[model samples]
Target: MIVRITSKFGAVDAVHKTPHTGVDIAITEGTTLRALGEGVVDRIYDGSANIGKGLSIKLDDGTQLIYGHMNEVKARIGEHVHAGEIIGLSGNTGNSTGPHLHLGMKATDGSWLDPTHLADKVANVNWINGPITQIWGLLREKVSEITIDGFTDYLADFIVAFPVIAVVSGGVYALVRILSKGGATWAAIGTMIYGLLIVK
Candidate 1:
């Protein structure tokens, strides 16, 4: 899913007193949030002055990821969480102008890192691949259930009238294509051809 970035790291606007420390993603209230990397929940904040109802996770590489402006926090302190695991829900809480998710990252050296730059490295879930694979499997199974004998029996009458069907279908296709050019004469001819086929 494409997420709109409401605020970018280091952007200094009227709303931000200081250079923004994190990227803000525009989201609706109660939207599910997921962990970006394998991490252990280290801190859970409740009604903090600035980051209300948020949580922080210490990643395997020692980097700390902070999620702010949440309505609910699902991960508990010291609990291990993998990438893509549900962590919380986005909300307009604590010092937020609207419903959005504030994502901040601190490097192992304690320096603030831009979350957008490292997004791909931490996001492990392939949202498109798994479901598509399952759907393809289902389609293959349905196709396999269609036996030649069963198909032949189902369309036995059509099979006997194949030559006539082919000729009529070809004529209809040609008539429609010619009609696309727009003329009363072609339309009349198409109607007559259709009527003849229906009568036959």
Candidate 2:
């Protein structure tokens, strides 16, 4: 059973979506958006990316669920969003022809997934549950910052290969990055506790 489909599956005016890139949910403006699964908010934008003004949530299993072209964002990065929870309002914000909700999912490896594939699945690890490792690593890539992403990833691949230094340093760095992003004032600070430390 298709929860949603194009307005015109056969007609010329039908919502023609790209092949396997996204799930086109036919909803008019002001439709309530729900979470695809349990996970933390990854990012929220006001019509920034090609997907338009939407939000991204990563499940505990590393699968990423992205909702695009929205009228409102009800979730924020780092917040543990639950399945079926309302996260936003559907609309035509991005490169869309009309008001609708585009739902897409991807694995931790960044492989695209479909609504059917998301029916029963799980995230293997909590990328956000730890410190700000991923965030700090990402920021450090932009500037001359010290991060523990490599070390953490290495440990993830070979748990015993990494020593205590990696864990301690990675945690410290992530804490600093979280503070930089925003300390206690942040909603999802828990997701970025494994970032790197910055020196100025």
Candidate 3:
């Protein structure tokens, strides 16, 4: 369940005099927040300041990851948390205009780093493989709502149709390849067909 990104890192808006330091992911209040990677809870602070109730984790690489504007903090200081582990709940706390999770990253040198592309770096890390996985469980619950008999029937139909689909796809590929190298006449015909099918 990917949520909408309400605000990106370095974005300047009415509320910000300088560029925003973190990415704001719009989520409903009480939405579960997860750790970005294996880290130990280093700081947990509550205040009416911009960040509101916040939590910081000291990652293995010596950098720190921060989660802010949380309605609740689940991790305690000095507690070790693995990737995707629940650390808090999203909220419109502090200076936030709406409910969202403010995720920030700090380098080992104590400089703020852009966290917008952090997902790309951790794309291979499955939430299901973590100790506190919730995504797959939620997906399972949704999938269970569908009838098994209907799903199996669709699967069977797909299995029966796969060979025909494969043969047709292979033939199309062969035709395209041949047409691509077939000098003038075939190229003209292929161009006409391509224009009709793809280029309108």
lDDT of each: 0.70, 0.58, 0.68
For model 1 the local lDDT of residue 175 reads 69
lDDT per residue (tens digit) for residues 114-165 in model 3: 9887643332232333422333333343355458885676567666765655
lDDT of 2 by residue, 98-171 (tens): 65667777778887766544322211122122234334433443344225885555446444433443555556
User: How far does residue 41 in candidate 2 sit from its true spot (Å)?
Assistant: 0.4
Best by lDDT: 1
Error of 2 at 56 (Å): 0.9
Query: What TM-score fits each model?
Result: 0.60, 0.51, 0.59
Rank candidates by lDDT, best first: 1, 3, 2
Which 10 consecutive positions of candidate 1 have the poorest summed lDDT?
A: 191-200
Q: Assess candidate 1 and give its TM-score to the true structure.
A: 0.60
Candidate 1 RMSD to the correct structure:
20.2
In model 2, where is the ten-residue run with the lowest total lDDT?
Answer: 120-129
